[model samples]
Target: MWKFYLFLLPIFGVNISGLYAKNDQKIILATYTYDTKDRIENLLPFADLLKSRFEGKFEIETKSFPSVDELILAMLKKEVDLVFISTAGFLSYIDQADEFEIAGTLMVDQESESTYRSIIAASKLSGINSWEDVKSKSKGLKISLVNENSTSGYLLPYLHFQQRGLTPFKDNFGLVEFTGNHKKSLDSILTGEFDLAAFGENDLQNLSGNEDLIHILWVSPAIPLGPVMVRKDMDKSISEVVEQNLLNLHQSYPAILESIKAGWIEAQNASHFEKLTKDFYIDFLK
Candidate 1:
């Protein structure tokens, strides 16, 4: 009887160990978009497909943050395994580039590669027509940026001004203010609270109904869009699995493909942002 009891103990321990291993292999994805609610609902089909394909190898979970800074904080603390961040957010840690690896990019359009421009817009009544026009009208003008941390909303425009030898506050670009979000920036411009605003071309298009109230005075050269990255210390095999899953998402889940208006593409190393280091567009707290 003693020998039989010892044998049963080993068999039960094996089952418990298997369950723990399953739980540990799960992956956590975090993003900073309000659209996360809709995205999650749309992603269910893809999630189910990945689970079926990966079997007991992995599981996927997601979370959302109101701002990219909050998402970055979570990543730094090892609370999230993967994240999707704007170019500016990624650039913030340019010096620590090796801390994460690019796994994939979201193709916003059907084209194999898509790029977006940065627009500097202002109320038509403000008479701002060009970058030069902005410099001339600087006396007591009010300006708004989507957020200090936004790539297109703040960094691009800020760097553009610097390159042209124009100092924002010193040259009197006006009272610099953060509108908190892109939509609000447009609203401020339309209502005359702000004489000028900066935002992504994509965001501008999304708010095109207000075209009569605002006008784009300038547009930046196309820049690389958003990227999905994983911690550098993550298990290589696990990262590879996530990469493959994303790349195959469109094929596996047609509904998700239509909803996001994008397909996944193979990702290259994200070291490309290194070139923009001199621009000082991104500021990583740590």
Candidate 2:
């Protein structure tokens, strides 16, 4: 029997002693990444631009990590004051932080009513023609997924499989590898290294990939991109300033949006991003 368990992963980051100690004049913001070596560097100019909005009241420091675990640990230690994290982390890891407060959602633009979705993709090498083929033969199937901390890449797809009676990489699939990011997951499929890949649909349209050789077996609902998170305990004035800037990023600070390839949007009809998370009950044989 399969269940849709709430996604809670174990910690994998090493403890950095005294990380919480920082200069009082500096604020730290972080994001998790894999293979985007320049992500941190790209964020620097954005941080500088954001700092400019603070009127010399404080400085912004941007950092990137290869693992969500490390990012979360930094948050726990109060070393990271703000974050641009994935939806999965927002849903499952919020309680891990004492002051986590969602400030805004990251969108393609202010007018992007709908966000990205997840897909179960297969490459030509899999010899799987369609959804039925995957459903019938997914057992022992070699699947490639992004890191466990990803929402579209892992969590949504995890529920998609369980709701349909298939739990790959846990009980049924032969091989399941974490490719680190959406592009890498897609790449793994194209290279014929796996029978299936689970990732965001946005990558299919935005990324330059051999789409002709891939087959879409399934697609999850519009799981919005990650949100901008801030520690509620942060200085009230600074927090208010950061929140306002993020909400108006597309219109007020287009340069920051251009640098990151996306802008922030206020949740159109909601006070928070509660709908972005899925409740699961998977029992992972612990």
Collision count for each candidate, in order:
0, 7
Off by over 4 Å in 1: 1-23, 34-39, 42-45, 108-115, 168-171, 206-212, 259-286
Please give, for residues 1-286, the per-residue lDDT of candidate 1 as tens digits: 2243234334433232222334466667666653223245444555555455445446667666777787777877777777766677777654544566677655444323433666778898787777778777786678888776687788888887677676655467658888776677778888878888887666666775778888777777656655677776665555555565566555654454454333211111111111123233323211
**Which residue runs of candidate 2 sit more than 4 Å off their true CA positions?**
1-23, 108-115, 206-210, 262-286
Candidate whose lDDT is highest? 2
For the record, the alpha-carbon RMSD of candidate 1 to the native fold, in angstroms, is 9.3
**Candidate 2 whole-model C-alpha lDDT, 0 to 1:** 0.65
Query: How well is each residue in 20-70 modelled by candidate 2, as lDDT tens digits?
Result: 333377778898775555367646766875566553446678888777777
Residue pairs in collision within model 2: 3-282, 4-280, 4-281, 4-282, 5-280, 5-281, 5-282
